[model samples]
Target: MESDSHDALDRRLVHALQLAPRAAFSRLAAVLGVSDQTVARRYGRLRGAGAIRVLGLSDPERLGEVRWQLRVRCSPDSAGAVATALARREDTVWVSLNSGGTEIACSTRTPPDRSDHSLLLQHLPRTPSVLGVSAHCVLHTFFGGAQSLAVKSGALSAGQVAELAAAGPRVAEPDGPVPELDAADRRLLAVLAVDGRAPLAELAAACGKSESTVRRRLEELAASGVLYYDLDVDWRIFGLRTHTWLWLNVVPSELAAAGAALAGHPEVAYACATTGPSNLHAVVITRSVRELYAYLTTRVAALPGVQHLETAPTIRIVKGPGPLPLSSPRDI
Candidate 1:
């Protein structure tokens, strides 16, 4: 019973951050109806346990960058090394070992001038241990970005959520050309990529800027959709233990419908339209394999215009949604 209560509080706290990533502890406490110290203590415990974390991420799409999803089929002995190499790159955002660790799936972002195929197609396949490689360019994101799977877990009361949502800056739409980053901007992003809620003084010191300058730049980056926070919460805490990535092939004419349908499914964490034979990709969470089976047979089968579907169970996640801290002019 105590465990359940603790997990509930953790979920609420995570959801609160999703609503307002930079909210003060006192604000969170007011929305949660708890003391400020209690809220801070809970956050400390969760962070210490590595059960949840907040990371600032740059939105590649908003920056007019290309994001590609690559699947690598490698010999069992070489999969780990290949996955580690991919994760070490500053471009790769998420890396996962799937299908019992023989297959690796990762997402990488590149600037407009950089060809997306070179890394996965020209490089990876030449290696003897790699059997096959497929790179799918992400075309449309049905869900993800500002959407939080933890929020979909519905851990907070509607009133509380409304109050929390009102506490943060409203997300502004990206406009005009992608903003060019100066040296200080790059340094700021590098540090915030690791910890979104870093103190202003610390950020100022790292970026070699005044606190007010750092504050203004941070707001501009966030408002422009160049940066935002992602709360990496353990889905197990929300009673969703199983994770599966689904690839769907749909008729080109019905692609929008299929993507929209999957986005509305509660089991789906994120869904995107992509290039290749499988035009749609979705990540979903469930309580058990049995529940996953039911979703595949019933809910997934019911989606309109889905021509073919393939599911890969995520065995392990090596890197998460946030990009690793990056350095160097080219990497940033």
Candidate 2:
């Protein structure tokens, strides 16, 4: 489907989803002013059309696994082959091709404090299919949640979408006020923070709350911009080979502009303004180091106010609730 049209339907669903993922069709219809069956049919169609996908996401860091974003650059013909090799690993979770180059990126769940780059990158360039590779460690996920929906779609009034998207939503800051969580909410989060696929009813039972109440609370939390949700796909089975994180230090004045530039690049999977002397931070996933360094020095660093750059190679993840599944924490 055309991205814009697809995005319109996604926006409508996302707005409603932010309120309640498993909301009754009648309730959804009431909000949307449509027939109950219409709500069901539209959602079914949306799922069938691949315009949206709903799944539980886990934080590799918190799951007693290692996590890193691996960057790869490959020959045009070798892209598929490289991806195939990568998909065969047991650590991979996500993988994709970037625009304009044989750029590919992947995320993997592994052990904490294990910096086995050579082992991870081993044989990466062996097939002549591999061009280059780079890996960056993930440190402190500032905001990891559902992607903000498109504002161009007509589903939401332009003003509404803008207001929602413009709120400058933030994630858990180490020193920032840690929002209070009621006993039930904390209980539910504890369950989700461990197993993303925990059943809703099970979670409710665990928290000594009604199923509906638990569901509503989950929705409220998501709508409040405190979580992100998505499906759990194991990419390692698909042959995605690497995971890495690169740390960088750029001129502060041009930080925003540089960050925007990096975000515009399809190569970047995630970015954030960190709390530190370094100023800005980002997570880039790609097929190879060759592609990664090229992007940082060539494409991203080229932005205005870029002064210095650094990278903390993630040896392995220690622990934390990395990101919520398909539901975004900010959506709440």
Candidate 3:
């Protein structure tokens, strides 16, 4: 699907969901000037087609966990198998084949106390086809997670955006105390990881709690910023065909400024600071190779203190924001 194939209503609905992932259908209908049934039906069609999905994800930093970006180089014949195996692991959030399918890029989370035993240190090293692995420990995220590229679509007017923002759940201050998720909370999150818009009754059942109790806990999690919603969409539908990763080395003094600047660019889908030779990392999506070149020569060249930059184009995405179905790893 391409941008011209979708109508204004589709874009508007997607933008609305980005602002308020769990907003009521009636509220969305009012803002979009459509019937409640229409809004719901549109959402259903988009989701059913696998063009988009809303997922409830947790902040690892807020939960006292660590996140890592792994670049695994594999033999030509084994890259796909290795990537598929990584995607099947519950610890991995997203995995993709990059650099013409010879390398795998994956984002994974691990408990802070178990860093030494993480999949990066233990499991990956044992794979016979693995040639090399580089792990970058994420230090800070400038943009991503709850921040969606849909925000740049310009589908919704400022007035409509403000109206929806006003009704959305309030985000707590970043420095505020982080809330702990108990067993019940973990169970609730497990179900939500697959479907953010899962019904309240379903959540209650998963957590083994009453609907009222589940509702209260859900509200608390969102308010505390421990849990937030994100959207996973096929960029091709929006006419974005080129997906590339930017590994940048910036002067330490200007790292924050450079990261913040990249985060504001429409082409940037994710940006963060990590502990590696390249301290800054970002994922950019453009409509074509020509547009990507323009972005690199213009916007990227103008960053504050970039010393070096390396671009890795993604070949295919093996996993996305939503959890993958449980399955055994295939033999390589």
Candidate 4:
């Protein structure tokens, strides 16, 4: 089918982008063995469809920020509205409806004022339809970063990845706190947050700096681990039809070992320690329900510290990593 072929090309393009977030069309074309125009045209089409986006994101770890996973149970009638309102907050990074549409789950970063707990303790419980709220601080991240969900389609060949790495900015995630950026750096990051692949001239204009200066500063920020790129794509398009979040109750003594073990599984996009009934949470992608079944039975059930587990299917992705999804007339 024509649709099938188009979908195939789109998946390949997405995979290539994940390997090299800011690679040039020529580089991608050569790696994919297609013409440069074809690569650019396919990328434009995918962007127009809202199926993929490349964002220059600040690494939360490098910024000394904590990520918290929040789960809200609301009345069926008010679930959508409550999720939408939460998605609008600047601190919330990802939002989705899960578990048959009655529950909302999201990831939020701690703001400068450290008001993350207020969301669960004070705000949502006060809502008329919210039934329950839980906040789980992400104490550790095992398998999240640029390579998180990018594994669905398989990573590029080592040689191809090496080639792309040689051609662009190298990343170095800092272990200790990196100094905060200046005003000029902030302006540059603001623009890139919108469009990571923006042209150098355009970035310079936005920041009121010369191209050479902009390039140097961008490299410095990346080298210092202040900024990183996230390659977002609709996993369904790549034949990964099942997405689920797993919440695990692990023994306190083995929490770290359990989290580390979950992170090693290829199907797991990310695994982290939390602060609630489910002390561990992971995002997983699979090709089908059957595949997910096999993973749970053979792989997950066998983990040492996992005493109990719950799985919630992600029904709708209301907001993603880059920006909030805008509500259109159709939403009403």
Candidate 5:
């Protein structure tokens, strides 16, 4: 119960910051119906917890940057070395060891002119596990941060937010047909796109309809796989300060073996099997630098088929989800 209270307060603060990171704490306190000093003191505590991060967003591809995903099959025994190497890479964004921990995945961003293949292929394979790799170039990331939260009250709700997010942008293929959205639904989505988690009553009100009717529409949209409700977490306030992106490369036959071995580590936050030169990508979230070292140096290296490693440290963060179009979460 205590944890929930702290978590709720932190989420409120984070929601406020997502709207404007540099906004005054007094303003935020006023909006939350709290004292200015309370906001300041609470933020200070959150910062100490390592959950609060002041950062900005950058579009690497916009700068003519070269980015790629590496999937690696590593020797389960030496996967830590792979993570170590990844931790050293300046361009690394995130890394993961897939289910069963035999395959490793990573994302990298760098100057378009840089020849990463040469360095990765030649240098990475030499890591202890000894394996091959595959690679993928991400064209763009359509959803991330608060953009993924489409819920807004008044005209929209959590259900609709999920819909707009999953609905995706207009398909641009010569032969592909576009899906149709009714005018009312479209208007609702626009409102939710700005704020998901809105009150159901407010959303119905905005649509000039009954709450039950609006809810039915949301249920239909959700059942269709249009979107999902993923909570926005302000992990920093919880004392989890460390986040690292790692890359690994493993031999083809060793993929499954390596992936399974590394995935069991407690510090790994996200892991996946991706098509790439390395054949795997993952993200590790931890509480401090010491834990990061323990993960990269010992736990990961112990996996099978492990070879090559690199990491990117998070310097700052900028955006996140906010309140729905409604005045409060209870309005629904």
Candidate 6:
């Protein structure tokens, strides 16, 4: 009973964070009906346990950058090493070992001014153990990043969510002009990428600026839609044991509707339209294989125009949302 209660509280807290990643503890406590100290203690415990993290991530679309999803096939022995090496690169966002540990899936972002295929052409092919590599350019994202699965948890009441949302930071209009990041902005973002809730003083120190300056810059970056916070939590903690990637080929005319529909599904963690054979891609989480089967047969089947579907179950996740601590190796 106590464990269940704890889990419920944790879920509510996580959901609140998803709505407002940097909201003050007092604000969270007010909405959660808990003491300020309780909110702080719970967040600290979760963070220390490696079960949850709040990351401030840059949006490639907002920065006029290109994002690619890479599927690398490797010998079983080399898959782990190669995935680790890829995860260590600052460009790679997340890396996973899939297909019984013979395949690696990762996402990388490149600046718009540079040739996006340089990494794909210059590396991986040279590695003897790599059997194949497929790169898919991400054209549009229907759901992901700041929009997390926690938002679908329904742990908090609608009124509570509205209260928190009202107090949260405002994001700029999507059609606004893209904002460029200077060296100081990059330094500040580097710190936030590791810890989204870092203190203002710490951010200022990292960026070599005053606290007021750092605060203003932070707000400017966020309001510009270039910087946003994301939550990384262990789904296992919530009894969500199955994680799978779904690649679907939808009729080009129905592509937008299909992606929009998938974005609204509770099982979907991320959904996007990409340039490849499979135009629509999504990450799904379920309690078990049986639940996944039901989702596919029912909800997924009901989508507008899914011509083909491919499910790739994740065997292991080498890296999650935030940056890895290791340095990139010269060779795999």
lDDT of 4 by residue, 135-178 (tens): 88888787776665664455466666667667656767556447
Order of quality (TM-score): 3, 6, 1, 4, 2, 5
Can you list the residue pairs that collide in candidate 3?
none
Cα lDDT over the full model 5: 0.52
What are the TM-scores, per candidate, against the unseen true structure? 0.93, 0.52, 0.95, 0.91, 0.45, 0.95
lDDT of 3 at 191: 87
Model 3 poorest 10 in a row by lDDT: 323-332
Task: Please write out the lDDT profile of model 5 over residues 260-288, one tens digit for every residue.
Answer: 66555555654555555656555666778
Predictions: Cα RMSD each: 4.2, 10.2, 2.8, 2.8, 14.6, 3.4
Higher-TM-score candidate of 3 and 4 = 3
Clash number by candidate, in order? 0, 68, 0, 0, 83, 0
**Which stretches in model 1 have alpha-carbon errors above 4 Å?**
1-5, 174-177, 324-332
Superior candidate under lDDT, 4 versus 6: 6
Instruction: Tell me the TM-score of model 4.
Output: 0.91
Q: Please say which candidate is ahead in TM-score: 5 or 6.
A: 6
- Per-residue accuracy of model 2 over 58-164 as CA lDDT, tens digit each: 33533345556666778877765566556555456445454333766666666555556543566675657777876655554543344322211246565444444
Residue pairs whose backbone atoms clash in candidate 4: none
Task: Please give the lDDT score at residue 107 for candidate 3.
Answer: 95
For model 6, what is the C-alpha lDDT against the true structure?
0.86
Candidate 4 ranges beyond 4 A from true positions: 1-8, 115-117, 326-332
Error of 1 at 230 (Å): 0.7
